[model samples]
Target chain A: MKNVRLNALLAMGLIIVMILSLAAGKVWVSPAAWLGDDLSALIIMELRLPRTVLGAAIGAALGMAGATMQGYLRNPLADPGVFGVSASAALGAVTSLYFGYAVTAWLLPAFALAGAGIGMGLLALLAGRSGSLILFTLAGVILSSLAGSLTSLMISLAPTPFATTEIVTWLMGALTDRSWDDVQLAVPIIAAGMVFLFATGRSLDALTLGEDAARSMGVNISRLQWFAVLGVGLTVGASVAAAGIIGFVGLIVPHLVRPFAGHQPSAVLLPSALAGALLVVGADSIVRILPSVSELRLGIAMSLLGAPFFMALLFKMHRELS
Target chain B: MLLSFENLSLTLRGRKILDTISGQFQPGRVTVILGANGAGKSSLLSCLSGLREPKSGSVTLDDRALLSLNGKKRGRMIGLLPQRPDIHWNVDVRTIVGLGRLPHSGRWGMSAADHDAVARAMEATDCADLAERKAMRLSGGEQGRVLLARVLAGEPQWLLADEPLASLDPAHQFDVLERLKNYAAAGKGVIVVLHDLTQAARFADDIMVMKEGAILAAGPRNEVMTADIMAQAYGVEVQIGTSDTGEPLVVPVRRL
Candidate 1:
């Protein structure tokens, strides 16, 4: 019941924001922009439509990735941002770009996808081998910090300051000046990851009771872990490559949406996707509309709101532990 | 067709958790594994539940080898409730209970039969009243019962629980044990690893006393609960008395 209501609200909100995102941007194309009319087609089809779709797809992917990892590990704090998958993917994209490997738009995200695979591989080899989530979280902290420092060091050693600054902005995150090609690259990867993660919703639900019980219920623990890692890696990694490591979309969207979804991990999955799409769209729209903040990226908007949220979660966890 | 452990042995971190031991679990009878702390009771349960593979033995359910079966298939036949289950997310009680219905459901959603199973299991565990409550907000006993509902709803042929009553109050403890007792009476094989000798003696059709990674005694409760075997297993003297309900009640001398 709660799920039905929330899905309806989300569907409505998404439709409104999507319309606003396309219609209210700097181009200010008329309502006819949605149709394939030439002038409006150049603005809407050639630009805003693709951007809006990309934003929603990446948002849904990141949201589902975050939801899957948290659900599987049984920890709310296990987002790609906090655990470092985003930074790792960024490092991969930036390094590939630094090496002139991203001459094509597809190459950067493709390389970023590979980087996410590496990140997840390392995580599974270290974290999944353990029988406990606490151990996994600790391992993630160490790996993420190491990845962050390595990224910083690479940026410092970079030869061209112009490209270095670009990389930094990308790492900090953005969804600005993205072309239709960027949308084309992100849509399929995110869509695939979303499908796989959603397929395992029942498995994630069983896992919350812990591994032993989950296994007895016929959940292949190791295989399920691998699937979750794959889901998070592809979705989050693809998003990082496309949108430059947009922070908090994956973490906070699920936190807000899960309650209304009745806390069923499976129910949380798709709604999380919808909420994720909605958040990025809303954030991107804000970035486009705010007059003085034309330079503001979606990442900046989210960080402004998300940093306090990170602190709140930490404080809340501390209180709960106490 | 009974579940049996053949020459099961496990060594973890260079120490034997379960020394080479052999046992059989008869169908339609409850096997209660009773032992003191550090006596490897939990490890034994883990082996049977396929959470941990025995280093040098096999767990067989009928003609099928548990070690060979994947986690999903084995889980269908074996319902296990481990000690101290914790939730990372705040989910509804019914949602948690519905998890037991996973083995019966497909990827897209649960069927009507699955929902019916959830409702019936919740009703059986006395958690239907609290179905709308958040799982993390429930009392430890309530959470435990909810998990029991989750396990019970799975309807596995063999139910293995490690210290199911460890944190429950007396009334809840009775509630949980009686449910297990009823499950066994219905011709399901239920193995409860317990520390409370009195509960084991009263409810177990068959009891095995484990000590030092091996079985000290194994038989019907009357045959297995001799004072000497209890002393060896628990490292204390046990005095047996009859309850008002004519079940065995155990009193242990304090270890000073």
Candidate 2:
């Protein structure tokens, strides 16, 4: 019932903020002018609409992947980030940027998605023979940390002011000057992620008890694990590559929603997806409103709010663990 | 006969776990395997449930070889409760149990029929009340009952439980055992690996005693519980007695 109420409020709020975000830019256009044959219509349709849609879509994908990973791994502490997929994806996007391809509107999200897929695939392969979740987590730590430092080093070595700015923007995350191309690139990948994860709902639910129980219940454990790996890769990879690191959407949204979804991992998927969409779009809308720094990134804004939020979450987790 | 293990031999890490063991489990009878630790009791159950492959022999369902079957086919015939279950999600009690319906349901979701079966299983195990509670938060005994409900809901013709009563406190232990006996009496075959000889003798229609991966004795409780054989398998002198109602009981004493 709380999920229902929250869903209704967030949904209405999302629609309202989305419209305002489309119109309430640096030079505010009348709603009439945007609907007419002015530059405002072009800005709304070709610029803001795609950016918002991509943000919402990627947010849903990341959120769904987080919930799925949490469910499939059966650990609340686990998320797409735990598997190192996010870091690997970031490396992929940065690599694309380092090569100057990140400037090409078409090449950016594509390279990012590939990097995510490869990172996740490698991580899963490393953890494949491990019979324990701890081993998988260990592998994730190794892969992501190694990848993360390497990405940082590349940024440190970047040749010019342009390279530094590009790296920083990618890392901090922003939706400014986002064209329709990014939305196009992210939607397909996110859709594919949703399909893969949603298809494994039953098996993931069975996995809650344990692999032994899931196997006894006729769930193919190895196959289901692959599905989870792929889902996380596709979703988190695309989001990170497209938007850099948007912190807390995966961790916070799913934790908040799963109990209301009856604690079933499968049931939490789309709800997390919707909640993800709302969070990113809503946050992006707020980023638009700050009059002082018009170009202030959505990612930086979120981290400013979420870093403390994350610290609180860590504290809560510690207390619960004790 | 619903299930049979035919000349089964399994080796793990160069040690024989089940050694050419042959057994027939019939419907309406609770067949209990009684043994000391390292007696290959859990391994034997694992082989029967298709968790592990026997090195040389086959477990069958109604003369059909279970070894040749896929997981789905075996799942319909045998429901398993392993010792020390490993959880990967924090699902509710009912949802955990509802997983037992996997074999009978479709890929997308559970059908109404599956839900009904799950409900019935949860009801039988007295866990219906805890349906929405997170399984990990439950006590060890409650968790055991929930897992049992899961296996039961799968509607398997045979049940395999490994030390199913070990984690439970005394009261709930008897309650779970009674449910097992009832399942058997309702024409389902049950093979339980038991550490408690008293409970074994109390509820089992036939007791198979094992030591070091081989059967020490196999017969009705009265014949299997003789002082000499019990001492040989257990490495301790023990007294066997019957209640006023004529049920077998074991009382352990020190080695002579």
Candidate 3:
């Protein structure tokens, strides 16, 4: 009953924020513009609608992916970005921008999704059938470092200042000028990834007793690992592909919702996803309404918010330990 | 029905964990395995519960190969209470107990029978009152009982527990032993690994003593609980006495 109420409330919150996102941009589209075929309607449909949809989708993906990773690893600090999929996707987008392949609207996202797929493959290969958490985490760290270094190398090797600037700016991440094409590319993949994540809820719940007990309870540990990798890989990869590396949604949203959703990993998943959408859409609206010369990058905004929250979490854990 | 293992051996990182061993376990009996630290007792239990696979032997349940059974089927048949009662999440006790129903519960959710099993398990372990309490906040003894309840919630035909009484107080130890004995009396198989010989003697219908990856002695508790077997397996000189209730009381005099 509590979960139902929470889900409904979160869903309502997300809708409200999404509508505000559409209406609160630089040139506000009043109710009159929503139904009529005018310049304001054109602005709402062509620009804000797709951006709003992509923001919600990306946020949902990051949030659920974070919840799944945290649950599977049985670590509160686990996040989708920790797997290195988002970094690899960023590297792929950077590669496209560096080489000018992003001239085609679909090429960069395609490259990013491909990068995410390769990241998942490498994770699976490195972790193998051992299903050891230490091995999986180590593999993720290695992948992240490798991707980060490669992206740095690409930036350094760029022939012109323009390419470097473009790469750096995209890396900061935003929904600025994203179109319906971006929405069509990211939303379906995110939805598919969510299905894979939802499949892991029961197994993650069993894992609260630790791995051996979870396995004894009939959770095929290797299968669960595969699901987690694929789920996080696709979702985070697609989000990066659509909006660049938005950080902290996955990490912070689950922590926020866990209090209301209960401690069970399964219970936290849906609420985290909804709250994530609410958070990103709400944050995007705030950035737009804030009196800045240019809109703030969503990625930078999230990191600024997330870094402090991460520190606070560490302190809480430290207090508990001491 | 019978659960039997034949010539079972296991090697981990080039170290032999379990030597070639053969045994048959029957339902309606409480089998206690005893040994010194690093003996093969826990390893044997792991193999029995299908948590660890033996390298050179086969375990069968009612004439079918144990490993051949699907994980859910195997889980439904055998429940394991591991030595560690580590609950990674601070979930409520009922939620933790409900995890035992994972094998039996369908995709839709817990059925009425599943809920009843969880309730009954908590009742059996005397943790029903702690249902709403956070599992991580419980005392060691309370945690032990709640973990036992988690295993019992599965309602498995066979229960394999490793050091279920470790860190538990004497009262809770006796309570757990009594619960295992009562479970066996209800026609289920119960296999436990224990360090306390007196409690093992009081609770176990059959006893298996292990030494350095091999079974040193295994038989009816009266025959296997002799001073010589205890000395051989544990390297300790022991005094054996009978209690007023006619249970064997074993006390270690000194290390050999």
Candidate 4:
């Protein structure tokens, strides 16, 4: 019942934020004018709607990815950002651009997906299955640096100055100018990733007792690990391909929702995904309404919001431990 | 049903943890495995519980290969309570205990049977009152009992526990041992890895002593609890006496 209520509340909040995302942009797309054949309606249909939908999908993906990683790794600090999964995806996306293959459509995200998959595979090889927390963290840091440098190398070697600017802006993360094509590209992959993540709910709960205990409870740890890592790779890769590196949505959403949703990883997943969608759409809306001459970057806005929350969480954990 | 291992051996980090060993455990008997430190007690438990695979041997449950069974089916048949029962989160005690029913619970979560099992296990382990408390806040002994309760909730046919009484107080220790003995009495196999020989002598129907990754001696408690076997396994001279309750008592006099 509480789970249902929490899901409902998050769903409601997401709906509200999504609607506000459509209406809060530079254009005054009122509810009455939303479906008419007027230019305002066309703007809503062609522009804001796709952007809002993408925002929600990306947010949900990040949130679910974060929750799944944290639950599977049994560490609250685990996230796609920390694990270099997103960095590798960004590197892959940048490589696609550097090779001018992104103009072909579909290739960009495919490459990004491949990069993310390799990243997770390498992490598994380096860290081993059920790696200790320190070893996993160390492996993640190493991978992140490697991917970051690769991305930088690609950016530096780009033939055209236009490519550099485009890459930089994309890396800043944005929801602007996203069409139905972008939405169509990212949603199916993100949805598939979400399915894998959602399926892990009960297994993650069983895993809270540590791996051996969880295995005794019939959780196939290897399968669970593969599903979770694959799910995060797909979602984070697709999100990065579509919107660049949107930092901290995955990290923030689970932490934000965990208190109300309870600590059960399965119980916390949906609420975290919903809250993530709400957060991304809301943040996207907030940035559009800001007075800056240029719209604030979605990734930057999330960091601005998420870093403080992360600090507060750290302090809370520290106090509790002490 | 018979739980048997044949020529089981395991190596970890290039160090032999369990040498070629053969053993059989029967239901309706409390089998206590006694060993000194680094005696591969935990390794033996892990292999029995299907948490580890032997290098070149077979573990069979009632004539079927143990490793061939699916994890859930295997889980429903055999349960293991690990040492140092670590709970990653501050989950409520009921939820922690409910986790044991994962093998039984369906996609929709706990059923009536699961709930009853959880409740019954908690009551038997004397952890019913701690159901609402956060699992991480409990003392070592309380955590041990809660973990045992979690394992009991699974209603497994075979129970393997590793160092369950190391941190527990004497009262809780006896309470836990009595419960385990009762579980065996109810026709389930109970295999416990213990350091304290007196407790093993008191409660174990069968005792197997291990040293340096090999079984030194194994038999009925009376047959295996002699002073010579105890001294050889533990490397100490020990006094063997009868307790007030007519149980065997092992008191370490000095190192050999």
Candidate 5:
């Protein structure tokens, strides 16, 4: 399929999913009720609209970040979380929850963003000037392990069971009861990060020829590295701040869209973004409509699906290698 | 125009890779660098292509410092086909070849002229029939041709290739050497590093022999392709003779 047509299809799919997200909850609100000044209209406007918008923004951010990472690293297994930004951001949010500072709503996200910034700074310090892929990947692994251990430590040391519950629940990731405040805080940041990721498309295309050839082709390796770090940090950090650690969207979306994009790194970016938004909003809607006591957490839902998909991907790669 | 370097030296990890090498490469000629392993042949090509900066010397293109030129301008002037070039994705051959136009492309994407260049490059390399095939799925020889077409698409004033025929069959090796020779014939500077002495002697307009990070011999091929130079540079007893077509051949007889 033509990239333009594929993009259009993805955009159309996203619009449908967004509408479903705005309407699918415990109490179903028809599209007609979304207009008038009544309880249904209030429900749609006050609650579901913000949640849907936030879901789309977070998904787009993660999707674009994933595509950028995979292209920059030239590894299909790479994702935004591989950079440790998401885990560090989660640690920051957990820290706020552990200290009971999350009651302010803004403090948690602020801490998460701060955590992401520190992770990015550390990454730049470790891998920035060298522009070596192995070094950058190893630094990310170390950062991820460190951040994960710290989060676990915070969980074990929670003062009360209730605090532990809150931290654990938030860490599972969801867009439940998210308001316009969350949307306002995260959307602009994710948009800004997307701009950075978008700028890397051409450079990523150059990188498919390997680092030496890329440099020969006028790609400034250090500059491209900085852009990848900044872009992934902001987008993944903001998504974690707003929606917790949503995994697999970045990893899976690019792969899903690559064939349609002619397998070009630059061509894969936009379609991945759109498909990511579609997947998240669609998944969130399914979780909302499930007949469970409480709505399933989106992060856990993604993991349940993503882990199996990951295994399948590994198997496929094994076959190809053999 | 001349692509020349002066007193170029490079040291990596406390080991000297290039030791104050100086040479001038003329346009419209195929200059082949021959050496043993670790003889700085590849490193010299890296310096000449602006892929590596020499420690304390200069590379100049037409009297302007090569390193001082911006990456895009330098890329437009010189294209390097590295040894073991990898196509990391499953992209088609046309797209792979089109990447050579990156340094000349504008923000909006490939121009009409850029497409023409890509087409011409594919035609020249005889890979137009493989344009729609996935690059990674092609045979080694086909992939090499596609990569060469990629460099040609850039239409740079200088082309430097390091062991471009490494993994190809003998037939494909001749094919690549002929392409390089034709490219130089069309008035672009061509520099290649080759381990095969006979191939170098057959294809090179000028020959440079390097040993232990220094040039052992360099001049017109007829002046430099000698048994004494081969023994000095490669530490091998060699027989230099002419083929039926009157092309020179260097056959290694024994270890020194």
Candidate 6:
């Protein structure tokens, strides 16, 4: 019953933020204007609609993906962005650009998806072999560094300066000026990933106990791991391909909503997804209203907001350990 | 129907854990497994619970290979509690116990029968009062009982617990053993891994002794708890006596 209440509140929050997103920009379009055929309606329909929709979609995907990955691996630090899955995906999309495949719409997202799959597969292999959190984090750091360097190398080797600028801007991550075409490209794939991730909720709940007891309880741990990887790869890859690299939303949303969800992985999923949508949509609105010469990238804003929270969590953990 | 192992052997990495062990466990009896450290007693329990596969031979239940059944199907019949119990989240005790019903839960969630089972198990284990409490805040003995309640909530036909008495107080241990014995008397199988031979002798209907990854002896309590077998299994000198209740009592005198 509490979960239902929380879900209802989060849904309300998402709707309110989306409305604020539609009205916050330089063109102040009211909800009344959106109901009629006018300039305000056209701007809302063409511009803010896709941006708000993608923000919620991407946020929900990342949030669900984060909860799934953390629960499946039994590691709190296993978000797609933190574990280099996003960086690897960026590398893949940039590689497509380097090869002049930007003209084709599907190839970049496909390559990004493939890159995420490979990265996650390798992480699963490593994590399965060892239960050491340090080792797992080190492996992610190495993978992220390698992918980041490769992406920089591609930018340096691009044929033209304008191409370099475009790659650089895309790498920074934003949802500005996106149209229905971008939304159409990402929504279905993200939705599918969300389905896959949410389906593993029960298995994750069983995993709250160690592997041995979970196995005794009839959870197929190996299959659950594979499903988590496949789901995270698809969702995070598509989101990155569409809006570059939106970091911290995945990392922060689960932490914020875990308490209200009763800390059960199965219960944590839906609330985290809703909270994620709310966070992104709210952040996008804040960026629009701020007095700035240029639009603030959504990904950068999240990191700026989340890094301090991450630091506080680390310190709290340290104090608990000591 | 019987739970029996046939020449079961298991090797971990390189070293052998359980070496060609064979045994039969019947319902309506509490079977206690006793062994010194590293005697593969836990490994045998793992095999019986279907968590670990034997490199050779088979474990069968009702003439069907236990491992051949899907995890949920097998879990509906057998529940195993490991030596260490851990709850990763700060969930409520009721929610933790509710996890035991996962194998039986349908798509929508737990049924009325499942909820009744959970409540009954918690009541049986004296954990119903702690239902709303955060599971992680429980003490060691409280945690053990909660975990036992979780396993009991499954209502499996066979209950296998490893070192369940380790962190529990003496009263809780006896209470738990009495519950297991009563469950067995009501026509279920209860297999427990115990280090206390005296308690095993007092509570178990049957006893299985292991040493060096093999069973030294296994039979009815009277037949298996002889001085010679105890000495051989533990490399110790023991004095045996009869309690006022007519149960056997074993005391370790010295290391051999």
lDDT for every model? 0.83, 0.79, 0.89, 0.89, 0.89, 0.88
Error (Å) of candidate 6 at residue B176 is 2.3
Order the candidate numbers by lDDT, best to worst.
5, 3, 4, 6, 1, 2
Model 1 chain B scores worst on lDDT over the 10 consecutive residues at B101-110
Q: The CA-based lDDT of model 5 is what? A: 0.89
Q: Candidate 3 overall Cα lDDT vs. reference?
A: 0.89
Interface RMSD of each: 2.3, 2.9, 1.3, 1.2, 2.1, 1.5
Clashing pairs in 1: A216-B75, A218-B72
RMSD of 1: 2.3
**Local accuracy of candidate 5 as per-residue lDDT tens digits, B1-256:** 9998899899999999888889899899999999899999888988888888889799999899999999999999999999986899899999999999999998668989999999999999999999999988999999999999999999999999999989999999999999999999999999999989889989999999999999998999989999889889888999988889887778999999
Model 3, span A120-146: residue lDDT tens: 668768863444667888988899999
In model 5, the clashing pairs are none
The DockQ-based order of candidates, best leading, equals 4, 3, 6, 1, 5, 2
Query: Per-residue lDDT of A1-322 in model 6, one digit per residue for the tens?
Result: 3499999999998998888898889778888889788888999989999999999999998888888877877777678888889999999999988887878998989989988888887887876435457878888888888899999999999988877988899998888888898899999999988888988998888888778778898989888887888899899989998999888787788899987777888898999899988998888888887889988888898889888977888897799779
State candidate 4's DockQ: 0.78
Off by over 4 Å in 4: none
Give the Å error, residue B130, model 4.
1.6
Least accurate 10 contiguous residues by lDDT in model 2 chain A: A1-10
Q: Which stretches of model 6 miss by more than 4 angstroms?
A: A35-37, A128-132, B242-247
- Per-residue C-alpha lDDT of model 4 across residues A93-196, encoded as one tens digit per residue: 88988888889999999989988878876776676366468888999999999999988998899899989988888888898999999999999999999998
Worst 10 residues of 2 chain B by lDDT: B85-94
> With candidate 2 superimposed using the best TM-score fit, by how many Å does residue A250's alpha carbon deviate from the native?
0.9
Give a tens-digit lDDT track for model 1, residues A204-306.
8877777767777878777777787788778987898988878777789888886577666777887888898999998898788788745677787898988
Instruction: Compute the lDDT for candidate 2.
Output: 0.79
